[model samples]
Target: MNKEARLSRLTRMALGRESSDYLSRDVDELTMVEELKNKYGLENVYRFDVGKNIDGFSPLIQDVLETPELLGLITGSLTEYPENSYQRLRRQLSLHHDIPPEWFVFGAGLESVIDHIARAVLDPGDHVLIPVPNFDVFQSVSFRMGASLTFMEMPGLCWDGNILESLCRKMKEKTYRLVWLSNPVNPTGQFIPQDDIHRLLSHASETRTLVVVDEAYGEYTDRPHAVRSASSLLKSYPNLMVLRTFSKVHCLPSARVGYMAASSERLRQATNTYRPMFPFSWFSLYMAQLAVLDGDYVNEIRRRNQERKKCFFNRIRQQDSGLETFMFLESDTNTLMFRHRDLGADALHGLLAERGFLTANLNRLTGIQNQGFLRMTLHGDAVNEKFLDACRWCGRHLFR
Candidate 1:
């Protein structure tokens, strides 16, 4: 058969989605980080575009790097590695969350775990409801499974206030295969209030819809008065699945370690069947185990982030009084989503880069209509000053 005739119907269907230049463009933006150095001098640009890069190399990473004989440890880990390292990690998490070890499934990242769940639960043309603007992964996985998608649109800066009620009503009327949501939501940095989350979960439970919650930003929101993560409710809502990562909270994105928490009878069992015999690299697994053991480092980062969060916002507001800047204080995470009327998100992104500051351009991520909202990460003092100075520079020079 000719090459064209050799492909399955599924392949042809997927290819049709991929064949769009717009789809390819979105894929390119998601995967690649464009270098934005000096237009002429080619100087380094401080990236603020990624709202989630670690403020600094984590102490756990530092320990691995600083150890002169770390190679000896890495090479010899297999010799004395625990026979049940995953079980041990699960035990640690189980103790932390008061959950059974069997309820959790580990993966390379929350994203990979999400894919596994989609594979296990979805059938062709199943309905998937994702609240926008949200992490693109949910949309991608839904489409990959030949599931239909209906987005409940929210402004890029924050969630629509009626989302919970609207979602519950929708769930009652339709049998959705899955629902995806993020805490301290991506790009926007808005978090759903805890009470609303409970109501939504109750509705999903009654309807038997699979609800996946990405809590990658859980660590940052682990503040004294912040909204708590949905993990605490896992025991009550078997229908709920929480996706968390060391990537965002523990600052171990490169290690790509993440896990899923679900009830023993549902996602936990199905996802286990989908789990590979060899899920990820041994080195990553080793590092993840160590990260869990080092709770001190995670705590310190969170504490410092809280203090830095205030200073970062204050610095931005103190800039030129002439330019009106709107700051969204609704987020309880490390990222701050904001915008200025003088520059739309895309144009502002380029201008900030010109001054050696990188910011997450929300126009593309949040949908074309919300071209004004942009998000920035809270970083260490040095990086914060660079970003703050860039903002000051923009107010003085880039005003429309």
Candidate 2:
């Protein structure tokens, strides 16, 4: 048998579809930082690319690392399995959301959850509807599952309510097995209003399509008294499933803990069947359980995230006339995507790299036109100020 012939058709197809431009490959954010540090020296390089670089783990979470019990788990758990299958974490999350614990399906991360969703819902030649300028994972996972894709493009990275309404109306006309959505969308951080999502959900329900809303950044958008997560609509829309991760606002990307909630028992059973066994480490599960319990800390992260973003945006708008080359796109979350009016995203990315700053190059990450946009996750005050200075220096040179 020939070497290429031995590979599955789906594997070959997925390989052909992989983009070298995407940063989520083997060269991840930290690896990029380390490589840059090697080239530019340690003290000079700044990481503006990854959202996981946000403020420290909550003090409540920090306290757990100091515990003797958690340390003992490191050496003790080689043979023993997790006894409760993460029931404690699920219970905490259920109580937090006022949902049934059994509705939750745990995965190693949102990436894993997404893969499970594709496995559970997609079949060969099945149709999947995705709104582009969103996470690439949805497209990759679905395609790998032998699903054909239809994309609704949001050119400005923010969905116009009217346009989304139109799409919702047309969605019922098509037979899609899966509908992928990202609330507080990745790269751009723009959110679809609940009403718009509800409309989509209604249409999807009629079509019997499984609508998966990825709420990885839901913490940044959900308020104290108000609800923003589509998880809130699970009861109202049985066709809906909401994906959440500990990676974003909880600052637990290292934990590899993510889960999805669906009110439909059938969907829940399918997802649960597809989920990876022992998806979380003992420590990771404990950390997530603690993180969920500390609601006040999560609230603080949300508030401070907004404050930092607002300050950064204000500074950009108020920059001197000569330094007006860059434009900040409005975003609803801590991660923001912006662009240079004069320079292309690749050019700006190279320029920033030369200046010892790393940012996400958002050139071909979308379907309805690439805007030469670059994205950055908001950092602390000192780091943001330094990044602003780098921008000012670049702006002055361009505008002068």
Candidate 3:
């Protein structure tokens, strides 16, 4: 009478492979936070765990959603049942990125895209090279697919010449079917430079390794100076695949839309081998299309995000609170990871949670070891001020 016992042996093994430390505390604590907020009617609870583009739907998106005609489309007969709305989306995205339409493939989200790619390419014992302290999905999916994984520890939370040399040396020494790199890495918020990526891709091309560059936070690096996307290198390096999501800068995570870019040949191989039928709903497709066309809105969001991040960083640097903090430099993403001098990440997380603030505790994430860092997303000025005040209160009253 055990439901879990009925699972296929493969499924059981996959479940067993799940990391006890990766995404365990933060995800579970987030669920608990939501329940308490709803049950106790707590309006002031702040969640810095999830990296949503903004607090809620953007003004333009909300306006589009409220349109009666637009809402009616949700109930109308399906226009493209077999192919769904992917044709339209592919065109828009292609025009946006200046790539051929055949170069794009859609998924419910980046996580879904990652799963699809893993399922298509990974075979039992296939090697996958991933840097440590990354988004846990990379590790989880590759492992579940029964792929051999090699984790390269990124020293100081970012890659340098030594790390790059070591990574390339490993690539030359081993045949990796896939290499997963998260630009502006999750949990760390450090942006790997374009030159370093080029160096890796150059080696990957010779080794015939598929380099999947996850640009989930790549849009955030556009302002002040543009960070050229690895997608631009797709024409030159056919071994490269770039993944992007509308969840972050586009403010449409609820729509569950994400896509991958590669050479048309690579797309054709993946499509011919394994393709998800109608991966996006009509409502999701419609909103995602609108979000994509609203280029001005996206640009404004990026501008404001950069300014707000700068202000937040400077304020943290200048704060006279008893709590001392440390942060990584050159982070161009929505999230920031830092540590309290005197408290472990779990202890600080507990203090903040009690004060109605939820943060991602990095005490046990791979590559972080016992560093005691916690990751929090950048919010608006007012909300960030409240968080800073909470930290000061923890420092002055609790620690002192």
Winner by lDDT: 2
lDDT of 2 by residue, 327-391 (tens): 78888888777788888887788878867888888787856246778888888877888888877
Model 2 root mean square deviation, Cα atoms: 2.1
What lDDT does the true structure give each of the candidates? 0.72, 0.80, 0.78
Number of colliding residue pairs in model 1: 3
lDDT of 3 at 400: 62
What overall lDDT, based on C-alpha atoms, would model 1 receive against the true structure?
Answer: 0.72
Give the per-residue Cα lDDT of candidate 3 at 81: 58
Question: What's every prediction's RMSD, in angstroms?
Answer: 3.8, 2.1, 3.0
Which parts of model 1 have CA positions greater than 4 angstroms off? 1-5, 18-35, 57-61, 77-85, 155-157, 223-227, 319-330, 366-370, 395-400
Least accurate 10 contiguous residues by lDDT in model 3: 321-330
Model 1 residue 158 distance off true place after TM-score fit, in angstroms:
3.4
Off by over 4 Å in 3: 1-9, 20-31, 34-42, 77-85, 223-227, 264-268, 271-275, 325-330, 397-400
Put down candidate 1 lDDT per residue, 200-304, tens digits, no spaces.
Answer: 899998998988888788776665433367888888998889888878766667777789988847667788677775666667766777777766666777788
